[model samples]
Target: MVTTKLEIHGRVGVIFHAILEHRHYSADQPPESLFQFIDYSNKCLETVKRSVEEYCAAKERQGFFIEQDNLSMFYETLCVGYDWNENLEDHSPTAFAESSQPPLPLPLIQQQQPQPEESEGGKPPKINLSQQRERAAKLKYKDLADYFDYPIQEAARLLNLCPTVLKKICRQEGVPRWPHRKVKSLKKQMDKVKDFMSSNVCTVEESASLQESLNKLQRDLDITVAGGKIAE
Candidate 1:
């Protein structure tokens, strides 16, 4: 399962580290595979960048000043425990202390609520088809795996698709495909459902019913395979 606590922290750390390094690290390092670390870090940075841009755009649409202080605070919180060489000295003692304690169980991070539609007086946001296609192309196969009732690997095979293809499709569809370090949260699940609703894949009512069907399938599986009891 992806822990937002860890992911958010990791992303902040990577961004801070990138800023500190100025020069991007190559795919080669020592001890623990530097290439993988650099690759993952770059991906995390991209996700953060997109999120910040979106937030800024939304605020602008509302005729509000983007709160730089809040952004900085959020960045700091996410970077907690990140060993950015420069920030290492300023690491919060409290965070270190918390690290020593048995890790507290944390609830999943909820997705941010969708912003309200732009006011009638505001200019409408324009959609770029080229950018949309590029984004849609990045969806992960694993995210769509359950929709096909297959493990990620098997789903990839059945679809005759590479993981990269699945990821790209997700991006084109405007679905979040990164930092997929956890099972899809409920909000993400709904987002996927919404995507299907918008596409020619299903009608709105069919999409809703399909979601309920999937939920029922999950409940039945839990009861039969996991020995979970059905509540009245």
Candidate 2:
């Protein structure tokens, strides 16, 4: 009988390790019960979440904070495998093989790419105002919050919005609120700043300055928007 195993393996911190094991029946087993796989996957995720939360809380109580980048790396490496027909297009055998390979490491390189313009005369292209507003309205606050590691309240405040209104906007945009708490660390903070800058709303120098400012603000503000002070 072919055996399918799902394993979660990673180092939580300098001295901590995390491993979760799960097994599912092979294709020869009753495939009609595949819905069990979904339940199994959910259980696996919940287990990982509980483990990581406990680990983080314990470390924090010990005055050793787990770096956000480390936490992100750990989650990224947690393998979630599903037992399915190898011949299925969505489950192509080659895809499984590729997923097992270690991701390539590369240095960060930024090259300026030219932006498309209306014409050589350099007149800025005209955009439909109504369409632009419609698109902007579609921007999901929850997804943005997740991307920036902020709570819905914090995200809404930063965007000069009402939490309920922003949440509705997110739902309209088909974006789900991130279920996990914001991971905290210098690396995560810098990453958030970089994302904001890359939105082309700010310059590199501005981004760097904002990153530094935000770090300082987080320390003072406790990374939450409270008492009318937006965390951003």
Candidate 3:
């Protein structure tokens, strides 16, 4: 059977002690040698498995859990180290590998920006965001409330989305298993805002502020109705 989760505090302790030993006994070695040693040790750990009782025992002793994302980042750093090692033709590959220079700093993660097509001439194409928002806002909170009266699958079908996606939206909105009552409550709140905006009791600045608040509430309600987090 495959291990869904693993606790490796003992393994980590061993590695930490080994690193300390290396630093003490082989003080002249470069940082790259230590990185290579850790990578080799991790590869060895990949083949081992522990029973449920053993895993629990390890957790009780000193638990360490590596999330999937962190593990991926760790592998990325290892790849960089391996590439650095491959580039050093003259350097000896050993536990006591010698180098006078310091190890290169790990590369920073850069977000990938959207690239323009060949026709765009380095400029991103114009997107009619207002029109998109208008379409999303078309499904009023009351209508959404009404839609939820049906089964989840049926309501999702009416909204032109799968049930799973609709449920995800509800979860994002922090509503119950379904958001019928939530939508109805938002609808009532919006109605109150509109009614207050129409009354002759506010100044221009206050009216503008009220309008902004209404727009924000509309967007929040529409996010649930739209069944996805549509970026502005």
Instruction: State the local distance difference test value for candidate 1.
Output: 0.37
Mind giving the per-residue lDDT tens digits that candidate 3 earns over 129-230? 335434443544334555765666567545544343444445445544676655667777889989998999978888999899899889877775555446
Against the reference, the lDDT scores of all candidates come to 0.37, 0.38, 0.43
Using Cα atoms with residue i matched to residue i, what is each candidate's TM-score against the true structure? 0.18, 0.19, 0.29
Q: Which stretches of candidate 3 lie over 4 Å from their true place?
A: 1-146, 149-176
State residue 25's C-alpha deviation in candidate 3, in Å. 81
Ranking 1 against 2 by TM-score, winner: 2
Best by TM-score: 3
Name the lDDT of candidate 3: 0.43
Worst 10 residues of 2 by lDDT: 31-40
TM value for model 1 = 0.18
Kindly list the per-residue Cα lDDT of model 1 for residues 1-232, writing each as its tens digit.
0101111223224442121111121122211111101122345656756754664576466554332322334334333343333232333222221122121111112122234445366854443433543453454433453543434334444443433344444444454342223333433565675667678869778988978866765555434322233465
Question: Which pairs clash in model 3?
Answer: none
Local error of candidate 2 at residue 173 (angstroms)? 4.9
